[model samples]
Target: MAAIVPVPVVDDLTSPGAQQSRPGLRASQSRRLNAFRYLVFALAAVFFGLPMFALFRMSLLGSRPGTYSFAAWKQIGTYPGLLGSIELSLEISVITFVLMILLLLPTMMWTRLRVPRFGRTLEFLCLLPLAIPAIVLVVGWAPEYNRIERFNLSGIMLIWAYVILVLPYTYRALSAGLNAIDVPTLSEAARSLGASWATVMTRIIAPNMWQAILNAALLSMSLTLGEFTVAYILGYNTFSVKLVSISRNSNNPVVVFAASAAGLLFTFLLLLILSYVGRRRRRRRA
Candidate 1:
């Protein structure tokens, strides 16, 4: 006869005690998770908020020691060509955004639908700008811009370079939107229902990816507004270039800091709006 062996019994998860404990365990985990999230948020606020606060405070510093005044902020308009440079930057931003949408949207959609194999190549070309320094890009573009100058297109020429500079950002944004949806299925279904390519793009696809498009547009505009290297090297006075010029030329350099702080605040506001809009859109869709 075989020797009798003792086996350990497993705890039954369905038992009343075990079932009652699970809710308590989950509640404890939820509390811990909420606490951790709040801690991370507080840390982030301190990290970002402190620098901005310092910048704003420094911008308000007066000429005398321990004095503070808003004169620097008010005197921003006194600087020659400062307003013009701002206007030029805004024009470049808007035009660059439109061109990016027109150029990238169709190409990306068509490529995804017809020539998916070339997607990697296209992505590589779009991302090539990130690897090449702005100075190097200006060197390559100088000759072409010189040619363009003969046509009397002064600041307008910057639009071409701006579009290329913003490629990596816009491409990534559009790619994220594309990846979130079934492009082929959507395209085929629309086509099967007698929808034209234009209809498919403008009506079916573009509407669904508006958030990504808006994100790309805002990024392109922000980059254009803050871009210094390409515009400076190419001899254009964009917003960033204007700020640099003011810091170097003005006796009261505090004004430049004030303007910079204002620009930063504007960008932050745009980001906040983007977040709010995205959240509202998601809720509506849900």
Candidate 2:
């Protein structure tokens, strides 16, 4: 009599309420997530790009209050020390590239691939370079080098300095790459098939990790090519040094702007190349 009470049956696979609720919930989540991503991207662009854009505008305006001209650009290329500085920078960057590879290679292999005590020690030591400030490094090296060695140090010192400075960047990249690969498994497989560690590293590991290595190289190249304090301290008249000298010594705003614009464009081009390669490599890896 109690009004013929009845119990509701729960649907196992197909339920109208569940099915209807899911699409709406999914749609709402997707919209919010997309909106958040867009917001983050916009904020990042504004934060990083706005200052560079401002510098570009300043360079365009040159020394003049309200006019634009190409005179600055002409002066930039035609400057007396520009070629020497560029060559010097190239030399430094190339040397740094070589040294960077050498320094990073072993660290990558040992730390992530081997993971032995010696490898750990090497990693800890390598990290010291990153932990020390550039100014501090320059200071320490200068006194000890000049006093003890009593030898003439030229741009080569700065070149090595670039190597030291960019070591941390390369190390992290390669280390990450090594971690991504199955090192111990690869080694045992190669060994069982009658391959030495050398062959394993060069043939298998290095090739697979090539993209990360390249990424590290590009980072070192970009950083070393545009360094300032170390070059100045070492008394090397590099491109960045000449650019700063030009800007500060005289009111040749046009030339300064042109030089800045050139530097920005060159770096941007390198960055673009690196980004494209990195993306392609990532996709291939995936």
Candidate 3:
């Protein structure tokens, strides 16, 4: 009233021009967000992918000047203990996975159905391994392993040791899968229909949690395949140990790179096959 100053209206705040500009502004923002996401993905790819690319390139380079050859790969078969180490590693991984499924799956399922209160305690026990260093674990096991060696095969002991290492991860995976499905309800229904405990577990629970089981198995295998410390410290000749020895002994980088590339490629293919199989089963179930 004093100055007769104009006051802004709400309508003026969202005028037709402003309304028209909003869609364009939103579209510009959306494009920018998409571009930023793509840039991040590209950067991430370059960050992780460049090293692998370089390793592959180095793997292809021949030991001699002005020459390129796959002698490194060819020589893998001739490495005295390599094939054995690979076989042994595969054996360990398979045995560990089987034992895990047989032991962990059933026990976890039972606990989920019967002793819900103890679930937290069980989880705590499983996670204790993560708190203990591998060196400490190996050191603790050394005396016991030496005693067992007198009577039982060390391979058996190795599998047991690996089980301890892989248990926490395997249990978590299975627990997640169990949680996703109504295991209690399923068990009740099965039991009402006169399904035995074994039948209920094998047919009902196992079929439903197939993906989780496979995931856990894959993780265990991957760990076993790449494990160097446990095997080395325990004086076992596994694939990783052999690879390390090769790297240390051979001056040529080609052999080391070739072996590494082979292992990486093989693991990729294995996972790819497993993924395809899992998808196929899912489609069938659907």
Best-performing candidate as measured by lDDT: 1
lDDT of 1 by residue, 111-222 (tens): 9888999999999998888787677888999998899889876686798988888888788888888887888899999999999988998899999888778878877877
lDDT of 2 by residue, 1-286 (tens): 0111111111111223444234556777877877897999999999989888877776677445788766666776677887778888888898888877876696567555566667767767766765677877888767655663357545655766677777666666667667768888887898899997778888878987876777677777777888887777766788888877877887654566667778879978987766676676566766
Error of 1 at 129 (Å): 1.4
> Which 10 consecutive positions of candidate 2 have the poorest summed lDDT?
1-10
Ranking of all candidate structures by their lDDT, best first = 1, 3, 2
Can you write out model 3's per-residue Cα lDDT over 140-241, one digit (the tens) per residue? 888878888889765546888888888777777677778879998999999999999889999999999887888788768877777777788878888888
Best candidate, TM-score-wise? 3
Report lDDT per candidate: 0.80, 0.70, 0.77
Instruction: Write the number of the candidate with greater lDDT, choosing between 1 and 2.
Output: 1
RMSD in angstroms, candidate 2? 14.1
Backbone clash pairs for candidate 1 read none
Error of 2 at 1 (Å): 86
Off by over 4 Å in 1: 1-50
For all predictions, the C-alpha RMSD in Å is 13.5, 14.1, 14.1
